[model samples]
Target: MTVVTQEAGAPFGAAPPSGDAAIRTRGLTKRFRGGQVAVDTLDLSVPRGSVFGFLGPNGSGKTTTIRMLLGLVTPTAGDYSVLGLPQARALPKVGAVVEGPAFYPYLSGSANLARFDAADPTAPRGTAARRVADALDRVGLSAAAGKRYRNYSLGMRQRLAIAAALLGPRELLVLDEPTNGLDPQGTREVRALVKEIAAEGTTVFVSSHLLAEVEQMCTHAAIMRTGRLVAQGTIASLSAGLAARIRVETPDAAGAARVLAGLGLPDVRAGEREVTAELGGHAPEEVNAALVGEGVAVRGLAVVRPSLEDVFVGLTGEGFDVDG
Candidate 1:
């Protein structure tokens, strides 16, 4: 890990609007004892009003980077800024829930938020309360606001934690595995809320291992492997460079095989009811042309696009079905 001087002073009174990039970091890294590198040299840019997803396998250092961003753990190297101010300089403007968003189980959701509001000297009580209500409504938890956190379900508690993060009306919200314990419906709710928040001009930084979820929600994403970033971009841009495969089915398997062979493509594998082939710049037209070329009857043709899960495994050299 490389050493650098920490930025001096905090931006407490009012944060300067430093343009639209909500989060930016250069060569951010962290190392613990025994030569363990939790976060390798990392650079990330999260634009304002974008819901950015940081995705990776378990132990990929998403938590470590978030902790560093929050000033809970100092980076061994590099510098970062949040909401247009240097991270070390804008500690007051960053709101985050790292790891499971722990809260005192004894406190009610409203009470917990009230305590946090009181603790923030910069946040007025009325403003905080209004923000809290907005947040709870955003996460679809206004009905559960008065329930004790201990009595709340895991999903409810997670929503409450998100509501807490919004209490100060933070410009940037960083969440680490926010949907870890959520059910399918709860996950959908949180995902929708995240998009809504970003739509309202707040920058959202979410870290999750769920590739499908991220693909559905985030406008831009970065993939990490072994604490190092391996891929970063809009999903469409990243996927555009990947090879396209076709999953074709036909009424006549033998006829399909013959047609595919006639196409003269190098890679072609025939299976029961389907044939997979490398589509080199060939659109659905080529598939039809091939079938017509061979007089084969084609029943169905489905283009196979690489999912984020496929891309993740391809980049990391790791399988996706890990127990963790």
Candidate 2:
């Protein structure tokens, strides 16, 4: 694995700065009345064309930071840019579903999307109907385009909200908790739609509290804790710093442990039928050969890698609401 040099004073696991970031921030912050700091000074970089997951538990300032980025909320301090342009200039090319999806219950899905497209001064009136149709199709809602918003399923409703965001050509799409409050099927539908959108070369910024959602949908992720970014990088790179372990299942556990310890593997622990050790800079083949040479019967051997959950807990000192 390639080593990434940390920027001076950056939080643990932060990726080095990139020149082609779709979104970048320097000292971004937000403080509400009563001196409650919703978001602390944050430096973020999201690479262009990457599906970036902005993740944290509830009340960890994820939403506040997003609001500041979208200009819906003013930051107490710091600066940010979207698509290499200032917020105001970037807004026209950006589509976002913030907080949650809201629509008139009486309006059909297509009707709601048409209304939204008409409200955009940058959208061409001549392409209104085509845009609406295309947006509905993009979100897999064309079959139910005429369904009343009140009658749409939770998943369909979420798709309609995404359709609204796609009413015009967008360079970037921001979705905040797009799968929140949905059933398993709904969550899957939204996840698939997000992947499809990203496949078409749009940069997607997803703010989610669910670990599974980010793990499955995002190409890159940034973890937040207590209003501060704790880690940021490609999913693979984020976990690369952690050590993997090797497990040997055998009756001669003590013999296996001794061989692993002799090979300089750390944390060698022997159980009745198993021996495990951290496999830092050591090859599993060499360890296996050494064990066999020592006459230890190896029933099973496996390399256990650090998961995203492990990375999260290591960085935050807390577990996440993994499935939510």
Candidate 3:
């Protein structure tokens, strides 16, 4: 339930994360040519050792913000830090899979990974093969390590891209639409891999439009709409922020409505077989107590909590695509 606090300076000017933040941004904004604002005054805080979901519809500025975080693009204003360091300085500890992997069609998966590892000037000498093998195994791609990149299925290629990021140890992994173009089985596999990766104590920041997938996989979620953050918090807390509602099915619907109205509950509606009302800081027991006290027969009573989807819709005033 922690709300992100944006800060341009490290606390006490120590040049570290304010607390346990893995990624922190303050007023981060990006405007493309023609004065189109892609991201607007974004402030984000991603805690270390957490799987954070960056959620939004298409072209909601998720990719642009991520690009700024990865040092791939310059922000029009504001600043961000990664792993307690400036992004450019801390990038060595960050691994990212953005857009998708670009590999030579003729090369084997292992060879492709080797080339990626070799490109890192800080990598150790003569460890490329072992690193490549371990990375392949980590992503469940050992069987496809020797296969040509062109022959690999879309799912296998995606896994290989992740393997490229894992050539060495990393403190943060940023994945943008990692499940895009994946089949059901592939989606399941990648979701499992994401969980496994976070279980190892690495912080994962995944940008996805798949709200259901994010709901299931993330420890925390931040939602955006049209280049602005609408809500950000733990999933449970986000859901909890919405008002709880109650629906009572009874033959004495009118009587129940009258009782509920007398009890100071707002918006009590009487239907054919139901009297529904916003819980409005009242408990189900209180409603039942008052209704039963008035000789109303409560045939059935249910409480409907607002779901993450409901919260998102309430925040953004639109439904979700559920596919990223």
Candidate 4:
């Protein structure tokens, strides 16, 4: 992955905002009352038009960071930009659902959206009806447009929240825990909706604790631990950073281990009928040839790349809540 650094005369390794980045932060931080640091020095680079997943366990400061980014909360230190512009200048083009969705319990979905659109000074009053309808259709909630907010299902409620964000044209969508507290079907519904939105060229910044959500929906991801970012990159690049392992099943496990060690493979371990070692900068075919040439009968050989869970755990020294 490319490492972006702050401008000259700033912190040595801080990340500066780039023109192509949808969202960028350099040393962004947040500290609450009574000396609680909710967010540490954070440098984030979210490329434009990419579905970026902000991942971490609960209370890792994901929401606080999002609040600071949206200018809802002031950061104690550092600077950030949205859509290449300062927060206040860019919020008109950005839509967000932070924390959770809230609507008048007695109001219908369409009514609630109409009220929201009317409240936006930039939204044209004459286009209110059309925009409300379009936003409902975009989130697949047109069927439930007239349903009361209190009568809507959990999934419908979440979709309504997303619809509210889409009441006007948005270049970026920031969703915090969009799939939180949802069942399997609800989770899938929200996941598909997010992809559909991204497909239309909107930059999506999703804050989620569910690993499965990030793995399936996001093209790029940034992981946090204890209020600090640990890793950030495309999913493939993050996974590639971990070494792939070569596994060989053979009756002569000891001989296979010896051959693999002789070939300079690290972590060579011989089990009852298998030998495994990290395939660092070495081809699997080369390892296989060396094993066969050394009189080791290789029954099976396979290269296993590390999973996303492995990569995150390795970086943060903590496992994620992958219930989804």
Alpha-carbon RMSD of each model: 7.0, 4.2, 5.0, 4.5
TM-score of each: 0.85, 0.89, 0.86, 0.88
Candidate 2 segments whose C-alpha is farther than 4 A from its true place: 1-19, 183-185, 319-324
- The TM-score measured for candidate 1 stands at 0.85
Q: Write model 4 residue lDDT over 1-324, tens digit each, in one string.
A: 222223322322223348878988878889899988888888888888899989877788999999988888999998888998766668878888988889999999999999888777788999999999999998788999998999998778888888898888899999998886677887887899889889999999999878777889999988877777777878887777677899999999989999999999988888999999889889999998998899999999999888877766676653432211
- Give the number of the best model, judged by TM-score: 2
TM-score of 4: 0.88
Least well predicted 10-residue stretch by lDDT in candidate 1: 4-13
- The residue-by-residue lDDT of candidate 1 on 1-324, one tens digit each, is 111112222111122244656877778899988889998878776667777889887898889988888878889998877776755546556667789867777887777888877876677766776877777787778898888788988888888888888777567889889898999998888888788778777778999989899899887777787788766767775565456777678767767777766676436778887887767667778878778677777778877887777776766654442211
Clashing pairs for predicted structure model 4, backbone only: 6-14
Alpha carbon deviation, residue 54, candidate 2 (Å): 1.3
lDDT of 3 at 156: 87
- For model 2, give the 10-residue run with minimal summed lDDT: 1-10
Candidate 2: tens digits of C-alpha lDDT, residues 1-324: 112223424644454455677888888888898999988778888888899999877888988988888889998998888898866678878898888889989999888888888777788989999989988887788999888999998778777888888887788999999887778887888899889889988999999878777888998988877787877888887777577889999999888998999999988889999999899899899999999999999999999987777767666654442211
Query: What are the Cα lDDT values of the candidates?
Result: 0.75, 0.82, 0.82, 0.83
Which segments of model 3 are wrong by more than 4 Å? Answer: 1-17, 269-272, 319-324
> Of the pair 1 and 2, which is ahead by lDDT?
2
lDDT of 2: 0.82
Please list all clashing residue pairs in model 2, or write none if there are none. none
Of candidates 4 and 2, the better by lDDT: 4
